[model samples]
Target: MPRLWTTRLLTALLLALLLLTAACEAEPEPRRYDFAIQLNGGPTGWPVWVEELTFDHTWWSPGGNLGGGFDKRPPSGGATAVLSRPMPAPSSVQARWFSYRTQTFYEIDLELPNTDALLQQWYRDYPPPDYRHYLMAGFSGEGEVYVWWRARCTVCGRDRSRDFHAPIVESAWAEEAEGDPGRYRNRTQEYVNEGVIPSPW
Candidate 1:
């Protein structure tokens, strides 16, 4: 009888440990927010192929980007990706893309406008429970990156934002373009400006 009791106690202890581990593992991670950026191919770099892109932000996922949306593909002269990240809003970012026209990979630093204040404004007016915030950053073929702040209600399609014509601010290239020595710079700004975003803004 004593031996049976000893065995049962050992079994119970093992079962308790297993339950504790399972509970710890079952705990869900914090909810993540959504954000996106659009990388447009400048005049000289027609149809940029984004190999990888990332923003300097909190731990949301591995490899900087979610590895979907526009990465590893050509944006046909203009494209961007919607990324998920913990944020106020990322102001600094990096892009490594291959220019098919240039036939070389170029890494450029992208500077986005800071919109934390706008985000705060929207959050105060549009509570998160009923609304979600979205950021739209556009890289102009004219060599300017424009940013916009928008909020939309989850329940309804209703949304509010400052349109492309009036972007919060345009981000400039913190780094100079040097790699591949392609049309990205050889072309005229006026000509580049003539190119429009293939994807709907």
Candidate 2:
């Protein structure tokens, strides 16, 4: 890894650890709203190959579960999951992705994508009788991760909750990309070196 990105990853990891240590202690209070993660963005022509994907959330929320657990993995399209309660939105993605640019599967801590614009879109979507809050993140050839602040009340006519929180995701949501199989597998092996995920090849 380049020095800059290595530094970025280290710094992000340390910060996330600190936040988790501090925030996990507090009991997450149940709120009026629930949370959701809608994931679907990927490479234009190729299916997204997810190795590992997790949201680095820095807040107190119940179960800290993001989405109904990415029910649909990559190459099969994205999925939506409903979690417990709303807290602050996730700050970044600690994920491993297969890069179409280099044909390399690598991991990094990436910040959320299209945040400012997404917030703008969020504002435009709500504030009448009912509204929703949302945030987003995406990477090159990587799936986009979105967390929604939605209404938990089934009886409520309008989605009154508008605060989003996020993660502790299912890494399996990432799947093998459709490409040169042997090459991709070989490179993945080189990168992983007999780690948690056994090589299918």
Candidate 3:
């Protein structure tokens, strides 16, 4: 009787160990998301920089309302990424924007000395339909070293900033253009002036 009991106990222990191993193997670990931005192709000597890049103040997941409606808040903010300082030598600069919410990326800014070709390339990447507004900084003006981005909304006067993606730039000192190099600010301004937005800049 004692021998029989010992055999049964061993069998039960083995079964329990097998069950525990199975449970541990069944589930895998989840992946964490790291939001970031990268820059490539800027003026030869200019250093990369990012400023005023604001993300949505609030957080919302699958079923949340992520508020700040069309009347009060828009969906996003803006940032300026450029080379650290302007370089005298001829060079090209490229800036990229990252969207953590959608897991998307786009080449938003690019500048080549004495050529509009880089600007044209930017258009191909950020087509009119994909994003509502666009802004860039790659020119010198007024001695402020200013670089601005398009505000989130041109219509409904709301900033979608409550739960939106902010840009992360790789370079710095990518100055603003004298005229509308990309025409993003001008277009957004038009929308705002027409009461599309509560405030126009």
In lDDT terms, which candidate is top?
1
Winner of 1 and 2 under TM-score? 1
Query: Which of 1 and 3 is the better model by TM-score?
Result: 1
The deviation in Å at residue 195 for candidate 2 is 32
lDDT of 3 by residue, 161-187 (tens): 422222222234433323322334453
Tens digits of per-residue lDDT, candidate 1, 1-201, equal 999999999999999999999999995653334544444444443444444556663322122211122222222212444454444466656655544333445555666666666565566677665665555443322334334554545666433232112255545432335554344343323334555223211
Deviation of model 1 at 7, angstroms: 54
Residue pairs whose backbone atoms clash in candidate 1: 38-80, 44-183, 44-184, 45-184
RMSD to native for every prediction? 10.4, 17.8, 19.8
Write the candidate numbers in order of decreasing lDDT. Answer: 1, 2, 3
lDDT, model 3 = 0.30
Candidate 2, 2-50: lDDT as tens digits: 9999999999999999999989898775232233544443334323355
Any idea what lDDT model 1 has? 0.46
* Local lDDT at 12 for model 3: 97
Clashes of 1: 4
**Regions of candidate 1 where Cα sits further than 4 Å from its true position:** 1-45, 57-85, 102-106, 111-113, 139-144, 153-166, 171-201
